[model samples]
Target: MEALRAEHLDKRYGADETEVWALRDIGLVLRAGEIVALLGPSGAGKSTLIKVLGLVTRADHGDLWMNGERVLDDGAPVADVGELRRSHLGFVFQKANLIPFLSARQNVEIACEIGERFAPRARADELLDYLGVGHRGDALPNTLSGGEQQRVAIARALANAPSLILADEPTAALDKERGRAVMELFRRVAHEQGTAVRVVTHDHR
Candidate 1:
């Protein structure tokens, strides 16, 4: 089954004379349990695409289906976007962005808890353990290594038990080895949890 899919997506800034198009007629279908990377050169709409997929930015024209439900049509919100992003989607960014004062476990739990209260603690622990960061659960974000912090970010993204996970330049902050480790962790999550993973990256390697 397709966890997330888009058709004829477009995003634009301004109108008429000064119009600038960030994305034009983009479409993608991602099946659950699939790990796919979004690759393109700079200014190729990667950010625009991710923003559209993540429900942070609206498309000028398009349709979106998340886990087979239509949430967008012609770039407009079909349903409540706040609910859509909160319940059905997970995201990881370039930096781990874990709260510095929060423990690894707390950081994970808070993200999941903010929208949905159920299973927050359990989900946090499960993801941390799965990502091999359970041992560092109580450590503050600043206390963990860069790779470990990134792992915690991955775990946090999984804390919601989402059907789809979207990552933008997630590995850009890590070294070569750590970057691979982050990507592999995403793959494992997609396979084991039956979640669809879309990673937006500029790393050609």
Candidate 2:
């Protein structure tokens, strides 16, 4: 089934004179249990496209459907964007962006509390364990290494059991080995959990 679909997406910045067309007539379709990577050059609109699809930014012209529901139509907003994001989408940024004062477990636990129905802490631990960061659950974000921190972030993203996962430059900061590991983690999560994953990155791997 289609997890996400965007058609004829167009985005521009600035007025006519200094205008920049970040994306033009772009289209994307993702299916459940799929892993896809978006690659482009610095000015290739990769980030802009991800933001548009992730609903962080609106597209100038397009239609978007998620899980067979029309969410965006010709720049119009969908039903409660925040609510839809919380219930159906998961996002990971270049940084882990975990709350500094919270432990890895707590970081994920808070996300679980937002849109989940089960015991938050239990679900958080389960996710952390599943992501191979179970032992670091009690450690603060600062205490963990880059890869470990990203693992915690992934666990947090998975806490809500979102149908689609959007990651922007998720492995940019890590070394080649750690970056590959993180990419592999995304692949595993998509196939094993039946979630569609889209990653925007410059890395060819």
Candidate 3:
């Protein structure tokens, strides 16, 4: 099934004279259990596209379908955007934005609790183990390496068992090897969990 589809997405900034168009009639389709990479240089609207897909930034004009449901049409969003996002979409960014006071496990636990489905502790542990970061569950974010932190972040993103995952520059902080590992992790998550994954990146390799 189609996980997400965006049609005629347009995002602009500034006035008519100094208008900066970030996304111009952009369209994309992602299917369940598929992993797709969006590669572009700086200022190429990669981030803009991610923001639009993730529902952080509204497109000036477009239609959005999530899991076959119309969530956006003609630049208008559904009534409960927050609920829709929290329940169906997961996002990872360039930095591992973990809560400083929360341990790796706690970080993931909070997300599960918010989702209000499975037991937070058990689900958190399961996700950490799935992401290969179970051993670091009790450790604080500060104690983990860049790669480890990113792994924890991924675990947290998966806490809700979302149907779609959007990552923007998720590997920008890691070394080539670690970055490749994370990319592979996304692929595995998509195929194994039946989640659709879209990653925005500048790494040409």
RMSD to native for every prediction?
A: 1.4, 0.9, 0.9
Alpha-carbon local distance difference test for all models: 0.87, 0.91, 0.92
Per-residue lDDT for 16-119 in model 2, tens only?
89999999999889999999999987789988988888889988998899999999988787667888789888989899999999999999999988986558
Candidate 1: lDDT over CA atoms? 0.87
Q: How big is the positional error of residue 88 in model 1, measured in Å on the Cα after superposition?
A: 1.0
lDDT of candidate 3 over 30-53, digit per residue (tens): 999999999999999999998888
Winning candidate number (lDDT): 3
Model 2 ranges off by over 4 Å: none
RMSD of 2: 0.9
What would the TM-scores of all predictions be? 0.94, 0.97, 0.98
lDDT of 1 at 157: 80
- Those runs of model 3 whose alpha carbons end farther than 4 Å from true positions after fitting are none
In candidate 2, which residue pairs clash?
Answer: none
Candidate 1, residues 1-205, lDDT tens digits: the string is: 9998899888998889988898888888999999899898888888878888999987889999998899898878888889878877888999889998989999988987876755778888888888999999899988999999999988888776788889998988899999998888888898889988999999964
